[model samples]
Target chain A: MAEHTLVITPHKTPRSTNITKYFSLLLLTVLLIVVLFPLVVITLNSFKTEEEYFRNGPLSMPSTLSLDNVRAVWDRLDYTTKLKNSFMISLATALAGVTLSLLNAFALGIGRIKGRAFFLVFFVMAITLPHEMLAYPLYYMFKEVGLYDSRWSIVVIFAVLHSAFGTYLLASVFTAFPVELLEAAVIDGCNKLQLLVRIVIPINWPSLSVLFVFFFIWTWNEFFLPLIFLISNANQTVPLAVAMFQGQRGAAATFQSTAALLGTLPCLIFFIIFQRTLAKGIIAGSIK
Target chain B: MSYKRTRGYIGFLIPGVLAFLIIVIVPFAANIGISFTKWRGVGTPEWIGIDNYERAFDDTTFWASFQNNLQLVVAMTVIPTVLGLLLAVFLYDNITHHFGPRVASFFRAGFYIPQIMPMVVAAIVWRWIYQPDWGILNWMLNSVGLDQFSHNWLGQQDTALRAIMGMMIWFQLGYPLVIFMSALQRVDPQLYEAASIDGATWMQKVTRITVPLIRPEIYVVILTTAIHAMKTFAPVYSMTKGGPGKATVVASYFSYKNFFERPNVGYGATIATLLTGVIILLSVVFISVQTRQERLESQ
Candidate 1:
């Protein structure tokens, strides 16, 4: 490697160049603040009493860190129940979706399938279609089949609807694996199932973790389908609960703020735990 | 290589293909079929043969929403792609040390927080900040002597769509930035070394080397962003509800209103079909251009 050069040398820099870099950084900082400030405001406000909230500006820090707002929203929204429902639905979707997707990806990507390209393209096309277009049809279909209003129905819909895209992502990971290793395993009298469990699963833990975190976050954040399909507040996901809070109009701010604070917690926790894997998954998912 | 091996491959594809057919393909085809009918989703359907499409074409709300979507597509495609490419280049160039990429990646993840956050949460938070009377945004503006610029951002037609688009750009910048960074890393370091050896400057190295190698990704970004812009619903639904006299409406939101809110399933299906057709056309054009470029390079 060449020696690293740091120049404090008096070089003539163009005024425009200096202005552009400074401008870009300034703009970036402003954008970051804009994005993060509201979230911070919500969290801060959630700790303030209702009186404190009304008296002070939304941006102002709470005078005392009290959890009155949090307590009130939690009681009103039944936040723990909502959170449990959300977690159950999300976990079910992620687990089932990831497993099915891994199987599909393995078969299509590494099993020397004849029509792999056709299936891959079909999934891509499926992904491109507007999701809302399918909602009415799916609603009718599920109602006709008596699957409506069931948690399993929502879980199945979320999982299967997202399965193809997840498979498409996982297929890229499968494609990068060494084919010779699989062939050698097969030669050693390993069945297809055994080979997958022993060889592919062991080697692809990183990809699997990435997919898990991605699907978890996605299912946790999903709103539209859950809002339409899950009518009862008893079965409402966190996002749905939050959205329903908005339906009350003027009184919605405090409730909505509380909901926002509650809804973002799980995702923030997940991000903190699996930040690197989450980044990898996002980059991988986007490219394909 | 044998017939048995072929059977194995067929067996492997069966479950996935069947699931996809039932969940995705059937619903898609059903949506298309519904577009040609006069059903309110409860009654038996009557064949209306392009009436819904005609109504969609004539509906001023639909057109306005389509226009908003077009604006979004244009803004998102250009602004995010350009800004993301610039950020990718900056990170790649400035952060050449061991810890540079890691720090940049951390920032990239930070930027993605909006993307990962539920749209409901994002919209609620933004709505709070954009609240005209009691908003933090107005407070900050007044403090900075720019109070005149403050408005009910999501409640005003003039600034609602733009404000929402700004939110989208902030939320979406991370995905493309990360993709571009990966594509940038794939660029052979030797080329940059050779460019420097030939007395080419940093700008020249980027324009000639980095940009060309990442054209495919750029195309993908444009295609995805455009399609996503057209189909945006969650933010609109959560933030403005197509409000300030439907100024923030998009095609997908219109479809949603027809389907769920109004129960005009046929009309919603019509809008959806049109949206899908547009998306398919864009994708075809993009794929064809990419293929043509590849063929030219081969020759």
Candidate 2:
């Protein structure tokens, strides 16, 4: 069968293809520069002294690279406290959100569930409503319940807000699982919980991991909710800290660059570490 | 496969369903309810019927902001979608090459930095770059003997929204590009080869083969970008605060200020409800038209 049929076509000349390829490469290079130049300027200027920042152009290198600006930004923002709070909020949200979504997906995907379509529509509606539309009501409700300023308020809100999309993605993955495997497990008298824990989780680890990383990054970078909910300076996230820093440095030219750098560093490190998973997650979400 | 398990499903779904109801559904319904009443957070909301919506229609500031948002949607959606498709084609055609695809993917990720980074941080960096007197852009322009073109970009009413729209295009082009690249790779190579053997040029191949194959992805990208453009608040809030006489105030930012900052909860909800209605209507129209087209093609 492998050798049953054969077809051949003449290959195009390497010279023509090479010229077009080089032209595409040149265009791509120009785009890369335009996209990355702002970030490059920020990172470079973040290291320069105050006088050097003002005297030299933004794209120029400093005569002497120094850590003074970084240190100053660290102190000004009380970096340690903000970092700890952000970490706690982000980790809690990701863990709780992913777990709940997985459970929801399993129930809808594998279980002999009634009203699955209804639940799916509910989740879709949740995703469609803008976050701003829910802000005021949530604010008032949290205030009434006395959870407004607590870290748990933001964490729970973030987790709940994220669960809708997470469930949608995870459920789609679960639907692709083989039905025979689940039936075989059930024939052996394995319960739903045991089946989900023992079989489904292991089979879908890649998808789950992708969702986890995406949710972590999104929750960590979420700004508006934390800004509205977390009233105290002590509980502010990195984005809030950066916004406040920009507000304070509105008058000062030098501190703004350093502040932006300080704020972007953590997320940049996370992105570098999880670049592949992030790419997979982004593709998965967008393709559907 | 038997429908024997009744209690198990209920137990599994109860927690997630309850959470969604309390957090998402309740608030969403309450938002609609609140739009019909006047409230200032300090007193009881009095029923005002359609007064807020009526005022929103006549409000010059609201119209200006809505128009700005429509402009943003137009600018960001069309340009980036086209650019992304081109980039995706370039990458997909070079997929077998070792270094080229990697370099292209790296550029894709590089373009995504502005999107993933908090808008506040990106705005701060860009504000400095757009500074007229000591900024890099003006400096470069002057050096290239285009000094007449240099102006305070964010300070001018006429240019502020366009400047921000340009920033939005920069930030948003990556996601669509990545998605299109993946979709392009999934396109059957036989189609392109067949087209080429039929004496089709590159432009003809793209129009006759690539665009038709990627219509679904294009629809998704356009819908997502339009919705995103409608909900844009952080950039304007951080960078301009809808300044220069409300020049850059998109509807979302206007609603946000009215709701939280200015304590016009009724008015804010009215604007938000209207925006939501428009979005839903547009989505319905798009989906129905696509569904009809798909049905016709299938038949």
Candidate 3:
């Protein structure tokens, strides 16, 4: 069998082409294990008692499933508070950012504003400007304004950081839409604002909704700004809380892993559900 | 057809641009000024005329951090990208040849999950996996009779940055894989069939035909991933904290600590300015290369 026949283009062979097919299957399984291994490792540890975790090492399957670690971590990390903070900030930023960007897109992309090209270039350039570049100045300014700990500060910062992207996304959406329908609405006594609300939002809801979900996830996972702005445990988002935990006291394995697991679960579930759109936004960035 | 312009059009662009200006543009300008001043977070600045920049350039820690970032370019950008292309191509072959929708999407989703996983959570996961005694990696080595190989993966200086790089590769593979797969999905399959008719082998088809066609998408992946590698901070914040004595401290973390932790505001600002300039320069070069290639292709 090893000395066998010969090989040809994949089209000529049938599905029983054992070696290649098996190789492909094996390759995929390897990737699957690599990708999913972290989740499994954390989950397995989270279930085990600390002694069991130590005795069995990290490889052993949990002897018994338990939610004890998750429960303990929930209280320790103030999970609900951080989750609420994360949600509130993410929602506010998404709402404000998306709305502003939608308007900007409509103006420059559809309305043919005077500085359309300039705005487009400017916003696109923001994608390259790492947020770290302005981290300190914003830190000082927020401190001086005495607004650092307020939920509004995080919302405002995330919204502002992301609005340029929103503008760029929605600008493309606006530019590519059929102009006749928009013009028809304008001729039919709908004002610009009314036309945007009545026509564009409904027609482009699918495209626009992707922007919302993408923005929500981005703000939800945001770490650096919230780290600077929302200082207290009470005010910090989940990622910032986790970071402060690691920075201050990362030694506690049981608590930290549990907290990390619980915090990540929401985003994981959300992405699994909307993985297609997430991929689209990512691929959009790649091509752009 | 004539297009009518309305004042309301400008109305649409203002709110967003204003928010950006207030947040990003203003802070950016302020940082440039801040970089030149000899001030902490608060108080009157004594203009120090490039002293902070000079100090930053002289800082040994800054160079050490920069060394880690350069290492990341190979680990994070180059290796993962090469591996991702291979994964995409192989599965793409499976898709075009043997698999149906179920298999295709299953692999696609598996590849993408890591890309969307929050960085903090991912760092937590990997840190556990690299745990010294209790870590699965060391345990696996023991089971495989390679116990001599295992060490504290993210702890010591020699293996620490390298360990982080290994995980970084795993953490980053998804982006390029998904992007390339999407690119492959859009390719003209008839070209492959024609190549196959000409007796093109598997390697030939991939290298000679598929790669050249998907070159633009590949470049996009490289550029984006390169930027991500450069701007990384959360992973450092979570997994290592510049670690078991500064082995994994990349430039972003160096800037972050100087500003916030040490309160060296001016020096921190200088480091940040340098990083931003590098990012902008890289983006300009990448965009020009891409556009120039596009022009040549069009001709």
Candidate 4:
């Protein structure tokens, strides 16, 4: 049989197709609205003046869009400092996580070294076990070492913890790496370090970028560890600051929504920017 | 020599191993040791030998929290996995075919937006919406003449768990959807095409081809999301603080309360140890099941 003869386009009757199309579209649209509803409400309330929010309630149309709540929440929460702290922590975590993962993967994935299975299992546990199991002990250790309430502790913790996933991912990626390239480089007298710097790192840059992006956002969004460790206002990251602020009594509705909007905006912007990388990373990270 | 080259590569692992030991391994061991003791944060722990564990077993509050976590598994794991499979199939099979990939991806991105936000932010947004007097839910209820339905969602014991669970379903839906959609890409379009040529309805195609083909991704989604549900803390902490009389007290929050808030280090460590054991057990079981399935398929 000719292959072309076998390649027939599946036909659906137009009537059924039209009905299913409209039905699926309707279901998707309604679900999307429900999913986006909270975000939309928060964004709208953030723009509404306090007086209007109070007088008209949260659902009422804002008579005029205002930046007053945003400004108020920003200054009140010292959001700039929190954003800076979050950036520093996230950046450091991403850097440390990627470096550690790359090194580990190089040894395990390409080196085919001794105890690879043992190390792999160890990292898997690191990813699987809850941070709560590590929390009190870490809290005590950090306090004893004078690292408690310091941003460095969080950086160290997330870097190590989050790198489990990173190592797992990068190791698999590196395992499938072209052996011909390594052999060719070796024939050219490239040492391990030289091969890594010149061949491996440059070639695997996209995978490394995925790890970097995930570690950054995961660290940014971490709340429990930060809440436990970063006790001081000055050292707190963005999410911790906003969450801690929520615990305060008599917080106004408009201010609450404003804080939520501002707290959520940075990650939203990051997602929009790194979304393609994120989607790729999610599939890469989860499917294997 | 090649042996020397391999030895040098071993040097690459030193930093990662050292950091893992210091940061995770040591703390985890300490936490385990602490579980078998009696201490109040400051004093040296007295070796009480399973007393904390015994107490935890008897603790109604711990049991309540554990039960609540089971409910969350349904929210975070079961609901998301089911809904994600349907939505993934719909997007990949129907939307991509009918509306175009761009439209399908647009909806996918919308669903995923909440997953990218900080859990605290999502909790805060939901909390505000669930606020009693002036919140949107209440406002909408009153507007729709369903004033009787309005209540302080996060404040009432009856509504708080369900409210948080609802938020979690929304937060978790995108994870499986994205994973399954990508998994679907790996499926042979010809299978669907064959089924389509045979006049297999959409639901029939989903149940027959889409699901079995993406079984591996489905397992992954369930395992990871179940683990996520097991360790859920931030939403509970932020939204209700496991409040309205221990109604929403998840195991993580309970452990946290013992660890930090109430300062019961020993009992807290006990709770943490148990929680860790359960999570590890779940992962092991799921992984083994996946492996067995793969082996069977290969055979």
Candidate 5:
């Protein structure tokens, strides 16, 4: 990227440039606070009593960080079961969705089979097919099959829903693949599965990882599908629960922030840790 | 170049295609069929061809919701894009040269945290901030001697939709920021140096060079965010529940309400089918425009 720049900064800097630099820093600092302030509010308010929250008016540093609201919200919402269910459902969806896309991409992208273009268009069309159109029928369909109230049902639904994006992204990775790799694998008596398992997968792991992280986070945070598909309290994902509690309780419930913080905790932690990969993943997603 | 195609690829594709069929394609086709019928949430459907569609076309609620969707799209897409581009340009110029990569990235991440937060969580957070009695917005207004300007942000019909739109704009900032900043990084700096030599100021450079250079990224952000806004359901669903007299009803929420709230599955299917058509039309136009641009650029 630096190839574009002709180096000349060794000379004395202008006073105007120095002023602009400090001004930009100040602006960015304020903007950073604006972005972080809400989460900060949640974190601060979650520790305080309901009166303290109202009196503090969203700016009080928590008098002391207490586990009181955490324990309360945890018990009230059956947090343990819901978090476990969310992890299982989202993890399963991500695995199934990403794996499906990899094979689909291998077939349609690397193999260059006949009618691949048609399949490409077919999947692209699937991206725009909104869930509202299919939510009711799929609900009834699952009810008939006795899959209506299970987390696994959502796992299957999200897998298919998100694999469209996965296929779109992974296909790009496979399209630019060197033909020599495939030819060499075939000459070494490797079958198609071997070609994919050993060669294509290893080569495209970075793109696959990107797809996996995004699909996982997306599934974890999904609300509408969980609302439609999972009817029982035991099966609801975290977002569904937060939205339900906030709506039903009208933000008067002291633990609303507590629940919201708990619900967002996993993804927030993941973001703090793997944000670089997440950013790269999003960038990769857009380019394709 | 034998061009002899084996049928092996079909085996690899079976799992994905079958899942797509069961989950997406089957129900999708069933939705189209269902939209033409009169079915409640129950036993039998009476085939009433185009009746639901006709009802939707005449429905005031649907048009009102669609109008709200367009307004939200402008808020979510247009204003956000301009603001995000300005933020991106400022950080790209200032931090990259003056501070460092770490500072630039830290700023980017701060802007992105809300986007990464689940919309449900964000809704709850903003709901507290919009609390009519003790909410921060009203509190600040009172403090600033602008108490007359402050009302229940999410309560009144006049301000409910705009309040939700404001939150949408606030939370949807990071998408365009990342896209444009990333695109701008690729612009050859020699052009900037040459422009500067020709007596161009920073504003001129942005309008003349940076904007033109990152046109594709701008289009992508606009199209994607516009579609997102048009189809948005969560903010309204969580914060206002399309309440205060349906002031905040959006297309997605309208479709959702018909199916879930009213149990009008048939009509909901019709509305969803219509929304899908609009999205597809928009997407097709976007793709064609992008391709045309690409062709021109290559030329």
Candidate 6:
């Protein structure tokens, strides 16, 4: 944006600024390498057999690309089940979280209910509260309610928990909604529910979709609470499955990298698909 | 506008509030109550008010965990914000001025790749990279003829925390960088032109123009990252598990161990309650400071 307005610079740029510019480029290149090298190494090693890994050295390219290590690791971890579990939990949390946020924000932002400030502060504090603080008690409560070790336990906790931020974001977005539109709808006999479904939500679809993507990805990336809640192997999420392989002490090096690669692939796919939305959401999310 | 119509909106809040109460409010309150009683995983509690808090106050490990958390704040919050700011300014100011915007954005996306992966996945990758004998770090050290420095990066008390901090800084850098870069778009380019016309240096422009313009975003990033630091669990859990003789134990993992491993529910709750207090207190300070800065700016 600033580039167009930079009209006054000499046609031949000054030597000092040129030096600094290249230096910045060099620095960014180094940082990029540092940031990406581990991921590249993991991807590279995941294709190597254990024998290939031991014989050719960690840095060497494999003799031939192979899927044997990938298959072995996937089978050992039962990754298909983990993927299904993670997808179901994340999807449920996103849908429920956005719905809850819409309702709460409607009341707080548009409805201007009594004690809205208290509720706003309550939700803000909830967003800041650490997961560990809620983990133990939720664990005890879920066990008492016979929901422990159930995937739904994770879905419920995260939906409510993440909606705290969702409500906070959506409420701010809602407060800016034009009152004239609502008044016109009300005059046409639109009740509150109809107003939300027919008018407000459609108009604010961009922000709501951004919120949905965030809820989905955040729940998908979660590790701590799921580790505590989903105790059974049948119910474990993807990250938990990968984390259970933490020590992998006696296993071959190829197996660990393969686990890392598999664990990251789903989120990497989401990132590629939702990059722009995620960027916009961060901007909306940071504003007061 | 009528009282009855205003009451209608409260109906929208019932489901949200009900779920919030059950999932967050009730569990939170129960955790606080559990802090005051003596209990294990399976048994009824005995009232033991102040005993758990006292134990935390005396427990050296508890205090060390918090100290380690402060280190994480530096890694996750301070270093990231500082570096992210410089990097953002570089891409926004220098790169865009010299190269095309596409190049700058390509760099931004590359830096942000790490933030998109699950932390557990990142932790696994880094753990492998830091593996003592066969890991890349050791291999690179040997290749460079510096093999003596190639010890177990994660197995030593002296290096484990620092090693994890390095990983965190790498993991955390992209968030603030992206936020600040976007925030920079809101900055008027004319300000930079005017500063240049006045013969101001690049450092001067950054200090006087860029930093002041994006202070709010900086505050938001700091607060969020600091909270993440305080809740440092996944990385520590996967990499070190608070190992090398409690060297990398953090508040969250400490409380977690107490809860499950030790089965000391009361003491775990005490640690959690204290950690929550610290976080809330930090948040209050960030918010108040930010609001005051905004007021000052408006004035």
Highest DockQ model number: 4
Fnat of every candidate, listed in order:
0.54, 0.55, 0.74, 0.86, 0.67, 0.80
- A1-288, model 5: which lDDT tens digit per residue? 464343444333566788878887997898789877877877887887776766666677778778888888888788888889888998899999999999899888887778888988888788766688788889889999999888988898989989998897788778899887787778778888888889988888888887888889999988887888887888887788777774224335358778878877887888988787788887886664
Predictions in order: lDDT: 0.78, 0.80, 0.80, 0.89, 0.83, 0.89
Instruction: State the fraction of real interface contacts model 1 keeps.
Output: 0.54
- The lDDT, on a scale of 0 to 1, for candidate 6 is 0.89
Identify the runs in model 2 with alpha carbons over 4 angstroms from their true place: A1-16, A247-251, B1-7, B94-100
Candidate 3 docking band: medium
lDDT of 5: 0.83
Off by over 4 Å in 5: A1-13, A246-253, B1-7
lDDT of 2 by residue, A226-281 (tens): 87899898888888888888423432555777777777888889888998898788
How much is the TM-score of the A chain of model 3? 0.89
Clashing pairs in 6: none
Q: Could you estimate the TM-score for every candidate?
A: 0.89, 0.93, 0.93, 0.95, 0.94, 0.95
Per-residue lDDT value at B95 in model 5: 86
| Collision count of model 2 | 0
Please write out the lDDT profile of model 4 over residues B173-212, one tens digit for every residue: 9999989888888888789899988999879999998887
Per-residue lDDT for B1-299 in model 1, tens only? 21123335456567767877777788889999999998888979889999998998889998999899988886678788888887777767654432356666666666667776787677776777787876677877987899888888888889999888877776677767878988887888788879889999878887898888998888888888888887887888888889889798888888888887898899999998898898899889988998899788779
Question: What tens-digit string does per-residue lDDT give for candidate 6 at B50-86?
Answer: 9999999999999999999999999999999999998
lDDT of 6 by residue, A151-238 (tens): 9998888999989999999888888888888888888888899989999899999988999999999999999998888888999989
Model 2: lDDT of residue A145 = 98
Q: What's the iRMSD of model 4? A: 1.6
Give the winner by lDDT: 3 or 5: 5
lDDT string, candidate 4, A159-259, tens digits: 99988988888888888988778888888889889988999999999999988998999999998899999999999889988887752244478889988
What order do you get sorting by lDDT, best first? 6, 4, 5, 2, 3, 1
lDDT of 1 at B146: 99
